[model samples]
Target: MAHLYRRRKQYWIVYYLNGNRVQESLRTDNERIAKDKKKKLEYELALGDLHQSSKLPLPMILEAFCKYMLRIRTAKSYKNEVSRLGYFLARSVTLSSLCRQGADEQRTMLHL
Candidate 1:
């Protein structure tokens, strides 16, 4: 199930769709508006009108990844990897840009 949370006066919406997870950070000061947007997204997901996570903006992936890893990574080896990668990610571009770059890099590497 999807959930909503607020951090540093910003609201974030999170959900899963099409076997892939999705998230969006609404830079709104109002929690109610954030919840409304979240509900609308949930409705779209339920209707299957929203495409896979890849189709959404790349920022969503970055936010989702960090959130997921921080909350769920329990294995020592996996945690270490995330921490190491996060250092690079935190310094690089915004989550959206990083996601695009990462995806493109993966695609190119796969063809090598």
Candidate 2:
């Protein structure tokens, strides 16, 4: 379940996901719009359609990808891919950071 509240003249929604409380701004001051967004969020949550991958840490996602690769990829190929991706893990790169920084900035950061 999600509940809507007003803070600093803007509406926000709070809900629990997997026992963790998540709060997000509705980005609107209008009560009706806030209500609509809250309803939409609840519907998405109920259907499990919300894509939270952008908020996931990079290393966790990389680990999952490596596991999937291991199933179909040769050991050598998997090792090479993992080593390439390990740089991001070592630096604690995150999905959100990459999205915010844009592709060019990321390439520069990686010195590629």
Candidate 3:
């Protein structure tokens, strides 16, 4: 069974999957839609068809972007492309955190 609740001014749907608790934001004030989404999530969970990677971590994505840039951008204009990429990466909360450690540290951290 799934349940809906409100917290911090947002409504969320909660359910169980393989005995693990899962939660998703409904982002609506309508209780009816919240309840309906909760039920749908629970049903999907029971069917074992959840696509978790549809939600990718930003750091992982940043690493992939770096690899892509390396393969496509030349060394002469690499700095320009890196700067542009930084702007794109900054939009992700997870990637923004990785940027704070300095570029060298971030590279080493991503390697691990």
Candidate 4:
């Protein structure tokens, strides 16, 4: 379950995910708006679709992916993927940045 609280003038929502306590600002001081947003967040969390991926940096995500790949992929395949994705890591890419780009721009950026 999620709970709402006020901190100074802004309202915040606190919830748990994976046994971790996560808190996010609602960015509104109004109780009604905060309550509505809390409900939306709870619904999203219930559906298991509330991804925090966009907030993660490319290098961090790449590192986690590499760890997973190492467990199931051949060394050569893992190496190849790491090398390929290294380009994005070097450029400090984030999921939100890619999402903001146009389709053509994304294709060009991905060299596709």
Candidate 5:
């Protein structure tokens, strides 16, 4: 079984897997969606997995961006693009956090 709760207006699920407690954020406020996610998690836990596949790492994403930028931009511009991607990734913010902030602030940060 799982324990469902809300924190900072986000739904989370806590459950035991293989005698260990695991807590994860569902990242949604909707109860229906939270319930569905929790169900899926439980099912996956029964199968001895919380995820079916690994997500792309930050370095891999930056490498792809670098590859794309190299094809179109000047060397200096490509270097700046790589640096900016590294800066954003280092901050550890999610897309939702970016969307919640003011556009001007995001623009200033993106320019760096």
Candidate 6:
């Protein structure tokens, strides 16, 4: 259950999840807004999908996937994917470049 409390002007929330206590600020003073957020959080927690964690790097994820693929079965496309991912990692580029390139393509499409 999500508990909503007030700390001066900002509303704070606390809940016990997976034997760990999670406390987060609602960043709002309004009771209605805080209640709505508390309800949403409670619903999400019930469904076991409230992931409050950082993501692993793309190269690390790809490396783990390659290892898993090797353990399961071999495929030509999978091998190619591993090779391509390795080349990208060896180049030591941040993944934001890929995001920027996709955004640029979308901008061009919009301009057309």
* RMSD value for candidate 6: 11.3
Over all chains combined, what TM-score does candidate 4 have?
0.49
Which lDDT value does model 3 have at 101? 35
Global local distance difference test of model 5: 0.67
**Clashing residue pairs in candidate 3, if any?**
none
Q: Would you list the clashing residue pairs of candidate 6?
A: none
Rank by lDDT (best first): 4, 2, 6, 5, 3, 1
What are the RMSDs of all candidates, in order?
14.8, 9.7, 6.8, 10.7, 10.8, 11.3
Candidate 2: Cα lDDT at 94: 41
lDDT of 1 by residue, 5-77 (tens): 8888899877877666667788897988988888888788778898753466657766567556545654454
Cα lDDT tens digits, model 5, 1-112, are 8889999899989888667677889989999999999888878777777643436875555445555665688656754665566476785744223334333443464453
lDDT of 1: 0.64
Give the per-residue lDDT digits (tens) of candidate 6, residues 1-112: 8899999999999998778888999999999999999999999999998976545876565545655654565455544554576576785643223234343443353342
* TM-score to true structure, per model: 0.44, 0.49, 0.49, 0.49, 0.43, 0.48
Segments in model 1 whose C-alpha atoms lie over 4 Å from true places: 53-112
lDDT of each: 0.64, 0.69, 0.64, 0.70, 0.67, 0.68
lDDT of 4 by residue, 15-53 (tens): 988677899899999999999999999999899978664
| Model 6 TM-score relative to the real fold | 0.48
The count of backbone overlaps in candidate 6 is 0
Task: Give the better candidate number (1 or 6) by lDDT.
Answer: 6
